[model samples]
Target: MFLRPAARRLRADHPLALELAVLVLALAGAHLWRRGATALLPILSRAVRVDGLVTRGLLAGALLLAGLVLYVGVYALLRDIDVGLSVPSGRDRRSLGLALAVPPLLVGLTKLVGDLTGVPYNGLTMSAYGVGTPVPAVLASLVPGLLVGACSLTVVCQVLVQGTFARVVDGRRAAFLTTVLTAVVLSRSTGGLSAFPARGKLALAAAFVLSLGLALYAVEAVERDGVRYLAYLPVTAVLGLVVVSLIAATESVAELLFGATHVAVLGLAATSYERTHSLLVPAVAYLSLLLAEETVVLLFEAGMRSW
Candidate 1:
């Protein structure tokens, strides 16, 4: 059943084409958004200057609402696909879980290492400007972060789609290609975030390799020993500590919250996918969390300015 020829051909042809199209469209959308935001900055500045706390709050609320709407639309689209796809097999489930877990863990490790080594990990940042900045200026600061979130979502969706296709094709080469593509997509998506220092870049590279290794090991272990292999929760706990420590080390409460929310959402998405085998669930969950985090941070910054 896993190696059916019809499945192989369907996977080899249609999914690859669909993935390529999605990648092209996503890239185009991101590029256009960045450019359009840049062009609109002056006009936005004039129109939405945050002169008072009320305006700041209003701006925050508006952005949050917009984010929610976008997420809902995406979720609806993904839900349609979910209805058509079958639940994955046990092996596929394990593989998906590992795939989802690795990337965010690696990101957390890079952040921890960067903090410890005095290198700036630029993978994620909460604020682009100081509090009390004009509403447009604040919005401008958020634009890049939102773009980064969008880029990350695109990468995750592509990874999930490609990974599913690889499984359907039942080819080791396809799986390896999926892994490589995932790594590449993640590395590229970081560009939308801050610029890393030299050491930070090296740390990120190392983390990527380590994550890929861990993911491979986890999937193999699960395949060999079944779900019992996942019973080694202590190791997972230690990794969780690494992420928590980094979050605690953050300079401010807002930063801490943002980091925590980021990791939590990623982990939750992975777990949800593992249980449901619905890619849409994780995608929508992650997107919603991203939006919520952005909203909270924006509101927090506005509040700080008000005080």
Candidate 2:
């Protein structure tokens, strides 16, 4: 019962490497496409006429919707995740409750962390790179901003990265790989790594390598005791450092792997809250996170990640 509710359409027949490749290609292509296609963001950041805004908005929406449709098609082809395209059964209601609740909890706790830390981000760094901060613009227009967030986050991070990758890697390794890779991608996309001045970047890299050696030792010791989740404290540190990373760039291998974190987490979350392999749970969770995310664009970015 528990299993079906979350993995109804999640059987994998493709070889591990092939599945991994397909997932990476699909999501990367989608992100690259969205990054290039997002002309509306520029409009949002600055003033534009109503007619122009409407026209640009429509174009962006259509483009985003097309990408979403393409993602759904890929899921259907590769994982049979057609949202099950069916009516919910009696058993689904409990899962539905979880679908509604968990995302908010995740977002809230993350936001709380940011609040405690004053909600700093790559905002200053991003601005330096000529990329206007998106949170404020997103707030300015609820519908358009949300449309971008939902479609982008769902396809790139939640479904493909968090959901699909987890199917291949399991246990703490799943979380470890997920977190590490996500951190890498975020660092690239946000200039987290690049933000450091020349010497600082080298220092950041050295610190990371040293910390990782110690973490690997710790991971081995703790896992010997079985299922200890907190064993990856260093991984959390990596993600946190990414949050404080002061630079931004694009299309790095790290960024791609990072997107995988979103795929597995959201994929699992969405399916768990429903009795079908539908997008409802993941979609709603991500959408809600977009709203709740404000400046804490950690796990979910609503849509805009690179810029």
Candidate 3:
């Protein structure tokens, strides 16, 4: 599955360590090349702004690379689970449609609900001022009411009728990766959570619990399509609510608890045995990053002089 020449060479015998070492050496060489004769100097000792575009790009790249590594790792682990994983029939179109549609429908409905109720929904930030209220907020408040409602109905119908891709991935690691990839995609599309009130933490906590329940319900839905055909209902409803809450409840305690690493830990826990639940490892990593980011942002803000 690897496209990079270096990545392919590193994959010769489960050589994950060798792959990492090679990547590090390549990066170091590139840095040295860029710095020319000054490469050996103590440039690494300089303090750097972690929130800058370059840093963001690096983080994004690392995320992509980590995802690739995890995908391969999961595939390797799947061999031990005794389930043969393969591509699903019609998976491409179905997945593409679901991926493209879910975000807009969820985000749109949030905007519509927020407008009618005066509650924050989707990415609507009240504190970020604009010339006569934010234009996006105004549009969000109105258009989604009708458009999103129709789209949601359409998606629900497709999910109920098509019953897409429930058979191809049976291995535990594959299952975990599926959930993680979904969560990560959702997280990126949901945007930053700096707009939420501190009180929204309650909403966030509730949403997390609800998402966990929905994950279980989704498994059941795949199993039962009994005479009632009501299996997908609960899954759709809980997921819908969770999606809205995730986008609207940014910057709250709930967001911190359900962030990327937390989501990964949850997926891993669900896929593995109870005794193997290592959630705290990802929790600590996330908190450390948050601490580092907070330090940099605080220092930068403190240095700014108010006009």
Candidate 4:
């Protein structure tokens, strides 16, 4: 019943003017929030006790956990009113498996691309783990990567853009719009249109588009064919290689990993919402992952500094 109504609404002629206006407003809001957060970071750092490794780790973890809670609360409040947001429903083990598998594969693909392109891949970008045989530094850096994966305003904006795209369009257009808009929004958050060299930014944007397109395809395949969705692997791998290669050419390995992982997470979140008609599941899962990653990275960075 809910699915039918939601589908019908998506197919109906929604006014493009209204949609565009809303999109502009959302973009503006996202920009302001990102700027505000950036500005607040210095003041927050000064106010918080971060002199020691333990203090820094605790502060970082607390802040990330707070953000996760805020996001979950917002999603819960908006779920009922927005067609794009949904309540969790039946479980799909296959979707869950796919979601779990995607992140590691993305990390591996980034490493492979970096090797091929002769880019120095710094796996421990968040921590100085290699300086000495320090257990705390290793734990601090690794724990976060294994835990949070990475969560930022970029991810929040992505969910908003992709969810909105799914509500308004279907098929390829929806996928394209989701990817393009995410890139535009994330780029703006990072440094506006002129942040990087034109060529570098273009390459990075194209990589995001390609990676997201493959991710969308994977989600659709899994939904339609279940286990037989393994058929999509080759295509996914090839596309990933191209996307990573482009990223390697234009950015650091850390940036490539972040982009690829974010796309994978976005795809997982979108697919989960589509399958279960619930935003809560994905939101919870994402926040949990992000919290873990942030905690580990912060701990590692603090340890490295103290050591």
Question: Could you tell me how far off, in angstroms, the CA of residue 70 lies in candidate 2 after the best superposition?
Answer: 3.0
Question: What is the overall TM-score of model 3 with all chains considered together?
Answer: 0.27
The TM-scores of all predictions, comma-separated, are 0.35, 0.47, 0.27, 0.50
Judged by lDDT, which candidate is best?
2
Query: lDDT (CA) for every model shown?
Result: 0.43, 0.47, 0.33, 0.46
Give the residue spans of candidate 1 off by over 4 A.
Answer: 1-15, 41-49, 52-80, 83-182, 186-274, 277-307
Candidate 1 minimal-lDDT segment of 10 residues: 188-197
How many pairs collide in each candidate, listed in order?
Answer: 0, 24, 2, 12
State which candidate, 1 or 3, has the greater lDDT.
1
- The TM-score between candidate 2 and the true structure equals 0.47
Best by TM-score: 4
Q: What shift in Å separates residue 71 of candidate 4 from its native position after superposition? A: 7.7
Question: What TM-score quantifies how close candidate 1 is to the native fold?
Answer: 0.35
lDDT of 1 by residue, 68-183 (tens): 33543463366332321445566555545554454445445544554565434332433233456576665555555554454345333333333344433544444345444333
Write one digit per residue (lDDT tens) for candidate 4, span 1-307.
Answer: 6445433343343333234334444544444444555566557778864576656555554455455436534643463224334444446656555555565455456546655665323332333333344656655654553333233332343355545555556634544565445444343211112111234443444454444344444454365566446645655665576556556544555455555565555556555556655545455445543443333334333334321
Residue-level error in angstroms, candidate 3, position 304: 22
Please list the residue runs of candidate 2 whose C-alpha ends up more than 4 Å from where it truly belongs after superposition: 1-14, 35-50, 71-75, 78-83, 120-140, 156-275, 295-307
Which of 1 and 2 is ahead in TM-score? 2
